[model samples]
Target chain A: MIAFESVGKTYPDGTVAVADFDLEIASHESVVLVGTSGSGKTTLMRMVNRMVDPTQGRVTIDGEDVAATDPVALRRSVGYVMQASGLLPHRTVLDNIATVPVLRGTGKAQAHERAAELMEVVGLEESMASRYPSQLSGGQQQRVGVARALAADPNILLMDEPFGAVDPIVRAELQTELLRLQRELRKTIVFVTHDIDEAFLVGDRVVILKPGGHIAQIGTPEQILAEPADDFVRSFVGADRAERRLHLQQVAGREVVVDASGRAAGVLEQGGTP
Target chain B: MSWVSANLDTIAEQLLAHIAQALPAIVLAFVLALPIAKLANARGWLRGGLTGTAGLLYAIPSLPLFIVLPLMLGTSIRSPVNIVVALTIYGLALMVPSASEALRAVSRETLQAATAQGYAPWARFWRVELPLAGPALVAGLRVVVVSTVSLVTVGGVLGVPSLGMLFIDGFQRNITAEILTGIVLTAALALLLDALVVLGGRLALPWASGRAPRRRTAPRDTGQEAAR
Candidate 1:
């Protein structure tokens, strides 16, 4: 769980990035933050991992004020994925994924063992581990980025538009992979994106950010799609609210019958992801 | 001209003499530059000071550096020690920025990834930073070497009879063949050294292969987004 209390940030040059932003994230929850550029959504996310200290107010993860913790230590205690895939171009794929665990003081052998496990989770081939980020496709590099973030096995993961840099097809695939990973790992995730469909797809709680760092709406994707809180929320969510709803909705009649354990029985062809 | 061109055995002997003289000094230059480059790139206090110092050294003109350093070091005019110290200083002048800028230009995100992944600072430098910085470092080396070849001619003024001596002697004596031979050989050797750096860069940094021809999106991170 993460909490941001009255967080604000203003640069020395008089540019205000965030003003009095407050947010609470529940444990094991996937919260998607949607905003236009400079809405302070990413700044809010960085606060949880302590990458950027808040100029005002406090950010706590699981009730511990991150300011009290070493920013590096705090970061290791949480996960962070970036859009650039920020794969150290110098390191091989395996080494890049293993970076955090090693930094956390895990032995090389153990760190690599964990890295291989994560590479599998993110769908990276073992053979590709020896290659550098430069050698990878955009999608593959992002998977390594995800693996690297999870390397330390942090309780929470902060992803800043993790899939934004890849081609659309790869982006969609990564989005699906992310959802699947979240289901399995269940680490609390703060996903930031500008795309409405992405926020809808992965967020258990979708928080739409207003232009000036205030919350426009915070609710389940269903709630926001069915009833936006105000004009800003509706406009920000875009005019295709009905179509976006289709991606979130499930019709009972069209549902695929599954075993009691919820394993997939077959495709629910009658109803799509909506 | 005859000493270099007449006999295959003699040319080989001259080359061996040249390498014996050049190799240790070149290796020392790389060793010296690594740390200076790193310091210049990473340390805020060192950047300007190192840059300023190096620019001053670079502008000193090689002949003066060789002349001045020998007197400054209290060495005889013809000492190889003076020759090397001058060359090493000149190498650092160029290599410091080469290494630093190479390291600086490495994606900050990649470094964040390294640190986030729990890599200690030193480990990150070795495993991540150095490899990315390799191309630029080699580029710096190329500049150092070609200039060293030219500067060695200045050392000839100090009475060290190498190819540089041949050129300086040729210039004063107005012997076209000898001067031309030295100049031609120096250029040829400089090219050879450059080729070696490129080869070594490719070999040592196989991971640096391929230039992503695609235009990367100028990663648009809003003030909030940029922090992560």
Candidate 2:
């Protein structure tokens, strides 16, 4: 469990990034903080790993204060994934994945064995083990990034717009992969993104933030969609958007679900009454 | 041709002396420049101060440096150490700025990623930063190698007995072949050392070579794998 106790961050230049923010993330829960630029979503996520230390208050993991821990050791024990994949361009995929374990004193051969297994888990071919990050496609590089993050098997995974650089199709594929991975390996995940749809897709609970890291709303996607807390949440989630309003319609004598835009979303299942 | 044949032993001795002086300067300058460059990269004031010092050091003429260095070091004017030390100062003048630029070329994202992955500062420097800076460092080294080799000839003016001695003796005696031999040998030596540096770079950084060709071919292999 990660807890941010009234945390705030003010830069040396006097820019208040996060002001009096508070949140508690339960163990094994994946929470997404979705906001625009300057909303401090990334700042909040980084505080969990001490990448950005709070100017006021504290962040604790599993009832232990993170500030007291050595930042390097704390980072080694946490998994971090970021935009642009962030895999070292000079290292081969296998070596990149094997980095954390080797740092933690695992023998080279043993770490590499674990890395090879992770490559399979992350959908990379055995041949790619020898190739550098630059040789891989964007999607493949992200997979390597994911593999590297999972290499240490850390309890918490911090993903900051991890899919933002890839094309939409590839982004969707990675999102699905993350969902599948989460189902099997139930690590506590703190995801930050500007994309609300992505937040809804990947997060168990979504945190919508306004301009100052202030929570506009916090709820499951269904709850937030059904009852927006205020006007800001409604506009941010696009609850009033035509595409979000869905109804059943008869199409070719079969009941089909259609959005307010009249676009057919799917066919209504026969067993479930609408 | 007769003059060349007569002075073959002398030429061989000078060539060896040339290598002895130039190689150490080339190596020592590079070794010293890396740490200085890293220090300079730390802050704006440090960069300005260090690079300014380098530029001032480079501006001093080689003959003057040779004469001045002997006085400072208490070495004999004709000692090869004076020549080596002088040329090393010259090499550092050229190398420091180039090394600074080379280190700067490593992306911030790569460094941050290494840190976030839990690499200690020293470990990150060795494992990530240094290797990524390799190609640029090699490029800087090639310049240092050629300049160092050519600069060793200047020591002959101080009676340091290098390839430059041929030019001095030939000039006084009016022997065109001896002068020609000196120029030819010096240029050839520079080229040889430059080639060696290039070869060493290729060997050390295998991933840097033929990047465009690799990029074109790699996708096909992966595409085939994807089809399976």
Candidate 3:
């Protein structure tokens, strides 16, 4: 469990990034903080790993204050994925994945063995183990980034717009892969993204933020879609958009689900009527 | 042609002396420049101060430096140490700025990623920052190598023996062939050393040697492509 106790961050130059933000993330839950730029989603997520220390309050993991821990050791214990897929361009894929474990004092051979296994876990080929990051495609490089993040088998994963740089198809593929990995691994995940649809797809609960890290709304995607807390939430989530107005229509003797735009989304199953 | 054949032993001795002076100076300057450049890169004021000093040091003429340095070091006026020391200073003047720029060219994203992945500062420098800066550093080093080799000839004006002796003797005796030999051999030596530096860079930093393949393709079964 991770808890942010009235966490606030004000830069030395007097820019308030997050102001009195409070949230508790339960164990094994995937929470996505979705907001526009300057809303402090990335800043809040970084607070969990001590990347950004709060000026006015504290962040604790599993009832222990993160402030007392060494930042380097705390970072080694958690996984971080970011927008640019920041694999070391000079290191081979295997060596990049082995970075954390080696830093934590694991023997080179053992660390590499774990890295090779993680490559398979993250859907990378064995042949890619020896190739430098520059040789890989954008999607493949993201997979390597994911593998490197998972190298230490961390209990918590912090992903800040990890799929933002890839093409839409590859982004969707990576999203699906994350969902599958979450189902099996069950790590506590704090995901930050500006894409609401991505938040709905990957998060167990979505946090919609206004500027200065103020929460506009927080609920499961269904709850937020059904009853937006205010005008801001409604507009941010596009609850009034044509796409949200989905309905069933008869097409070729089968019931099909269509959006208000008349685009067919999927076929309605026969036996699963509510 | 008879003059060349007769002075073969002298030519060989001078060529060896030229290489001995040039090589050590090239190496020492590079070794010293890295840490100095790293220091200069740390802050704006330090960068300005250090590189500004190096640039001013480079502006002093070689013959004057060769003469002035012996007084400061208490070495003999004609000692080869004066040439080596003077050339090393010249090499540093060229190397420090380029090395600082090379280190700066490494992307911030990569450095932040290393930090997030639990790399200590020293580890990050050796593992990530240095290797990524390899191509640029090699380019800087080639400049140092060529210039160091060429500058060793200036020591001959101080009565030090090197390939430069041929030019001095040729000028006084009116043998144009000896002067031509000095110029040709000096240029050849510079080119030869420059080639070796390039070859060494290619061997050490194989990842930086070729154009990065932009599009993804199916993985190859063999590692031969990477070896290239």
Largest DockQ belongs to which candidate?
Answer: 2
lDDT for predicted candidate 1 compared with the true structure: 0.77
Chain B, candidate 2: TM-score: 0.92
* DockQ for all candidate structures vs. native: 0.26, 0.41, 0.34
Which of the two, 1 or 2, has more lDDT? 2
Task: Write the residue-wise lDDT of candidate 3 on A74-175 in tens digits.
Answer: 999999998878888877889899999999999999999999999999898987888888787777888889988999999999998998887777788889
Candidate 1 RMSD to the correct structure: 7.5
Model 2 spans with C-alpha error above 4 angstroms? A250-254, A270-274, B212-228
Estimate TM-scores for all models: 0.80, 0.95, 0.92
lDDT of 2 by residue, A85-173 (tens): 89888777899999899999999999999999999998888878888777777788888899899999999999999989887777888
lDDT tens digits, residues B115-210, model 2?
A: 998998999998889888999999989999999899899888888989999988999999999999999999999999999999998877767775
Q: How many backbone clashes does candidate 1 have?
A: 8
lDDT of 1 by residue, A1-274 (tens): 7899999888889888889988899999999999999898888887787777889999988788889987667777778888878777766788888877777778999988889988898887777767767666777878889998888878899899988877677777888888898888999999999988899999999999976678989999889978989888887886444333233224465554454444545545645576
Between prediction 1 and prediction 2, which has the larger TM-score? 2
* Residue runs of model 3 more than 4 Å from their true location after superposition: A249-256, A270-274, B211-228
Better of 1 and 3 by lDDT: 3
Query: Among these predicted structures, which one has the highest TM-score?
Result: 2
